[model samples]
Target: MIEPRLIDTGTARLRVMVEGAGPLVLMIHGYPEGWYSWRHQFAPLVAAGYTAAALDVRGYGGSDRPDAIEFYDMAAMVADVIGVADALQPDAPVILVGHDWGAPIVWYSALTHPARVAAVAGLSVPFTGVPTRPLGDIFRRAFTDRGRFFYQEWFRAPGPAEEEAERDVRGYLRRLYYAISGDAPPGSWPEKPAGATLLDGLVDPDPFPAWLTDGDLDHMVAELERSGFRGPLNRYRNHERDYAWAQAWQGQRIGQPALFIAGTRDPAAFGFGAYSDPLTVMRPHVPLVEGHMLDGCGHWTQEERPAEINRLLLDWLARPPLRL
Candidate 1:
């Protein structure tokens, strides 16, 4: 059984779903998602003899949604993770696991407070070489090769995208979720088909993955509809802020036992160039690193292939930490 708890994380009140008993494990979800995104791994990790908790990061689910973009800054988000650890397991450090946007937070947490994380695993998103360039340079690097870079900028644009998304949130969310999950036409990754903007009007009778049922979509729709798109979209608006903070830690390496799990078909795998040279970029910082590419899967690795994700988590947890 999963038990829900609210922890005061100073910046916001974060709601978490926790279960089991052993070394603490903290799970972070990505944008347009909540702790329910980790529903597949919760009980499995618990049965494997680890106390696991999946957090609804600030601004989503039951967590307080602050109104300011600065409030969603990397430092504040990382602090929420640290605060959760402090409130739940004051004496022991946690095994950090994150998906999508959550992966970035894990990377930051491990970098900022290495001692607080026992072992770290990132799903769908891998640790790119840290921010060593200005916001414009980062944008250019991200999009330099073909249309690889426009999507990130699209999210940051303060115009129709956000407005349309907020107009009919339920439909907009369904399309966004589908787009990332590989429901679009072939070769949709490197570049979207001609005239296919990311935030274009919702397709009639949206094509969501079969793996995600109406109940799952309903959960996402309800949360996003009530909260609107601002809270989540604001996460993208802080790219400059994140870049500035990450620049402070340039050349800093995260020395934790790290693992990255990617869906072979996930756009982000190739979109961010994470799969291109993961060993060179990730292994340098996290010396003890492991990578898994799940076949026939998309961005939503946990939901698309729950059993595989569960096995990966169990195996990673079994491995001893670097200094333990």
Candidate 2:
């Protein structure tokens, strides 16, 4: 059974679901999601004799939500992860795993505090080079020729976006989730035209796989409904601040064993050419890295294919790293 506990990180109280035994493994969930996202992996990891903990990042689930936008900055986020590790294990490092936005936090943590991470794994989102250019420049370049992928612009917009999202949160969140998963309702986005806004592509009605059941969706919706979208949505707004903070580690390299898993159908992978040429950017920084592509999965790799994800994670954790 998974036990829920709160780890006080000085700045915020992180609500975490922990189970299993042995070395600590900390899982971080992505945007619009919480600790529950890793529900499937918790029990399996426990049964396999590993301690697993999934945290509701600050502002999501039961974690403390600070009203200031600066509270959600990358440095603050990294601090929370370290705080969780300090509060729980105190002496030992942890195997860090993250999905989507969670991936970057783990990446930053591993970079900022190398001694505290045993191994690192990222699902759906690969570690791109630290943000060298402005977030606006990156967005403009990524979406310049493709109008269909413009919804990222909305995410970068000011206060009104979060206000609107919080207005009819359930519906807004459902649409956002469906859009990113590429299961938007009918006529959401024509496959032929690649230049659609991210939100536009999310309206399709395709049925998601069993991994992301209606119950799982409801859990996410309920969390957002209670917390309101402001705090979580603000995570996207801090790109510029994050870029500045990451500059300190310009030449730092992540030497730990790293694993990256992506869904074959995940547009984010396709957008960045991670599948066709995985080594181009990521391999240079994270030398000991392995990439896996799940054919039928979407952006939600863990939820869409929990069994496969579990198998991969278990096998990776069981084996010794190349260096050791």
lDDT of 1 by residue, 1-324 (tens): 899999987768999999999878899999778899998887888887888899888888788888788888888889999999988898977889999889989988998898888778898877765766655456556564444536656667556556777687667666666666645554444455323456654352444567788898788778767666666777888877888888878888888788898876686666455346554567777777898888768898888889998988788777765322
Please list the Cα RMSD from the true structure of every candidate, rounded to 1 decimal place: 2.9, 3.1
Clashing pairs in 1: 143-149
**Candidate 1, residue 18: CA error in Å?**
1.5
Worst 10 residues of 2 by lDDT: 184-193
The TM-score values for the models, in the order shown, are: 0.89, 0.89
lDDT of 1 at 223: 76
Candidate 2, backbone clash total: 15
In model 1, the number of clashes is: 1
lDDT of 2 by residue, 282-322 (tens): 88889888888887566778877789999998888888862
Error of 2 at 241 (Å): 0.8
